[model samples]
Target: MERLQKVIAQAGIASRRKAEELIQQGSVKVNGKVVKELGTKVTRNDRIEVDGIQIEKEEPVYFMLYKPTGVISSVKDEKGRKAVTDFFPMVKERIFPIGRLDYDTSGLLLLTNDGEFANLLMHPRNEIEKVYIAKVKGIIDNEKVRKLQRGVILEDGKTAPAKVKVLGSDRKKETALVEITIHEGRNRQVRRMFEAVGCKVTKLKRERYAFLGLGALRPGDGRALTPHEVKQLRAFASATK
Candidate 1:
């Protein structure tokens, strides 16, 4: 027997963390009865249902994609816009984007069918770092850099401390290139951080996530995650557990 969330994850329904949410929403079942407890366990002979649909176990698959600008991060969008899932028309397993990248932002994006792995990487408690490069309006001075490194107040709340650095500047264009690293994954966080400093971000791209980099992959290109890379991410996830 194994934990309910693990079963759902291994069954290719969703990530373990999302599985827990499904259970709490009363959408999952073990045998005939609804199982809302995250710790509930079941054997292989047990039947599981999610939203009244049976789940089948399958091998996990992981991929890293160079998410191009204008591509949505979700599996499907109601507006009928192309999404990351559209990039892999032939993938057989039910993989999903680990987190998100905005429609306008471009760069590295991870996709996987392993729910536990997805949960681990995206969960804030794990503190996995992501690096981004942004082109912002105006020059970034030492004071602005210090304020960013120290933390800035946002509409939601004060952002956590970040690692900030100026990369380059184009005085004629009134633009500066900056690199910022943080562990949190709040929506358009890097852009908001710059906005807090009176700078408007015009272009933003994720350079690296954890140990993975964009490397030579071009926009819309993708490659399977190596065995070693998967192992490292698994280690990262298990560390917080």
Candidate 2:
């Protein structure tokens, strides 16, 4: 037997956290009975339904996408905007983005049907490192870079110390390219961090996640992860866990 939420997650219905939310919202039923308890467990023979649809386990698949700016990182968009999943027209699994990038931010994004894996990577305690390249409105000096390295206060809270460096600056344009490495996944964090330092992020792109980087992929391109890559990611996640 496995936890109901785990089963739902493994079935590609949602992440384990989202699966728990569904259960608490009374959207999950097992054997025709609504099961709201997070601890509920079930056997393989049991019939599980979510939102009136039966669940079926799917072979887990992992993908790396070069999400372009102006695309939402979601399976669907109610506003008729282009979504990340629209790029995967041939994929059969019900994959979803592990985390989201802003509609205007672009770069490497991961998608998968494995909810447990997603939870492990997305969980704050894991501290999976993400690297971003930002083009900001003003030239960043060594002092501002030091401040970011030491951590800065924001509305949510003080951010953790980050690895920051100024790649280059254009005095004529009054802009700079800064690279920052952080583990937290706060909403629009990179942009907000710059804003806190009196710099506005004019453009942002995630260049790396954990040990993975976007290699030779252009915008709107995607490919399945290699077996070795997946193994390495799982091992890293396990170590962090």
Best by lDDT: 2
Candidate 1, residue 39: Cα displacement in angstroms equals: 6.7
Q: Which residue runs does candidate 1 get wrong by more than 4 Å?
A: 10-28, 31-46
- Per-residue lDDT, model 1, residue 134, is 94
* Local distance difference test scores for all models: 0.88, 0.92
Tens digit of per-residue lDDT, candidate 2, span 109-131: 99998878888888888899999
Q: Which ten contiguous residues of candidate 2 have the minimum total lDDT?
A: 9-18
lDDT of 2: 0.92
- lDDT value, residue 7 of candidate 1: 80
lDDT of 1 by residue, 1-241 (tens): 7888898876657777788999999999888899888779888888899999988765788999999999999989999999998899999887789889999999999998877778778878888888999999988899999999999999989988999988999888889999999988899888889999999999989999988998889999999999999999889766865
Per-model TM against the reference = 0.87, 0.86
Clashing pairs in 2: none
